[model samples]
Target chain A: NAGVTQTPKFRVLKTGQSMTLLCAQDMNHEYMYWYRQDPGMGLRLIHYSVGEGTTAKGEVPDGYNVSRLKKQNFLLGLESAAPSQTSVYFCATRQGGAKNIQYFGAGTRLSVL
Target chain B: QQQVKQSPQSLIVQKGGIPIINCAYENTAFDYFPWYQQFPGKGPALLIAIRPDVSEKKEGRFTISFNKSAKQFSLHIMDSQPGDSATYFCAAENSGGGADGLTFGKGTHLIIQP
Candidate 1:
C-alpha cells in the first residue's frame, strides 16, 4: 500500500511562474493536508481538505490554492510563485475517525528564483 | 502567533546517551500532543503521542511526558544511537476544533555522535 505519494519531487521556477504539486493517497483517507517545511520554521499548513470537494484555508494559505477533486488526490497550486514560496512541501492524510494519526508523503522540493 | 514553542534548536549527544526535546504550548484547548521524526529528505512520521489526561506514555525506546498544568510536553529518547540522529518536531491539536489541524513546533535538529 502506497500510503501517501507526492509528485514532482523537485522543481525550480522563475518568479511569477505557476505550478501545481500533486498528492495521492491509496489508504482511502478522508482528510488531506498540504504543508511547507522551511528551515527552523517546521511545517506550516498551507491548505487542507476534509473530504472530496471540500477545502479550507490553513495557517499559510495565502500563496496557494487546493482542490480535492477526487477522493484519492489532492492538488496544490501556486498561481504566481515567489522567492518566499521556495520551500519543501509535504502532503499528509489521516483516516476519518477518532484516530489523529497523519501519514505523510516523501515531499516535494520547490525552489522559486 | 506561534502556538507551539520548541526549545534547543539543535543538540548533539554521544552514543548511548539520553536526548530530550521539549515543547510548550499556549493553547489550553489542545488535547493531543504528538512528536514526529523526520530523516533527511523524508516526511515527518509520528514517533509517539500523549493525551492531556495522561502524564506519560512509552513506546519502545521513545517516551512522551506531558504536563497538563504547565501545558508542556517532552520526548525522551533512551540509549540514543547514531541512527537516531534526525529532526524531531512537536505538534498539538485541538480535537474540539473541527478540522483545524495541528500546530507544529519549529523542530529540533539532533545529532548523535558515534
Candidate 2:
C-alpha cells in the first residue's frame, strides 16, 4: 500500500505564478502536515490539519495555504508564487492512535525564478 | 532564538565509526524527540524516535540517547556506512500539548566516507 505520495515531483514558476501541490495518504491517518525544507533549514511547518475540514497555521504559514478536503488528501497552494518561496515541499501524516510517527511523501521541489 | 538547536552543521566520519549528532531544546513541554533522514531529492523519513521518559532506544544501527534534565538529546549511528551519507534532522514536539506541529532544527549534514 502506498503511504504518502506528492504530485508534481518538480516545478519551476515565475515570480507571480501560482500552483498547487497535492498529497495523498492511504493509511487513513487523521493528522496531515505540510512542510518546506530549505538548504540549511531542516524543515519548517507550513500548515497542518488535525482532521478533515480543519486547518491550522504553522510556524511558516505565510505565502502558503492548505486544505484537507478529504481524509486521505491534503493540498498545498501558492496563490502568487514569490522568488523567496522557492524550496522543496513535503507532506506527512501521523496515524490516529500513535505517540507520533510521521510518514512522509517523496517531495516536490519548487523553484520560483 | 530557535526552539530547537542542532550542532555540528556538517560532519564526516569513516565507515564503522560512530557519528553523533546533538540537539537541544528550550521548552520542557516537548516530550518527544525524533530524528529524520533525508537523501537528495527525497523527503525526510523518520529514522528513530524516543520519549523523554526513556533514556535511550535503539533499532538496528541507529540509536537515540536522551537526557531529560539537560533538555538535550543525541542520535548515535553505530557502524556508520557510506549508505548513511545524507542529512540528519532532529525535531521536537509535545505529545500532549504545544502547537501540535513539529519544531525542527537547522539540521546536520553527515557524510560517511569509505
Model 2, docking class? medium
Q: Residue B45: error of model 2 in Å?
A: 1.3
TM-score of chain A taken by itself, candidate 1: 0.97
Model 2, residue B93: what's the lDDT?
A: 85
| TM-score of the first chain alone, every candidate | 0.97, 0.96
Error of 1 at B65 (Å): 1.0
For model 1, residues B17-90, the per-residue Cα lDDT tens digits are: 99999999999999989999999999999999899988999999999999899989999999999999999999
* Top candidate (lDDT): 1
Off by over 4 Å in 1: none
All models: lDDT?
Answer: 0.94, 0.90
Clashing pairs for predicted structure model 1, backbone only: none
Native-referenced DockQ of model 2: 0.62
| Cα-lDDT of candidate 2 | 0.90
* Candidate achieving the largest DockQ: 1
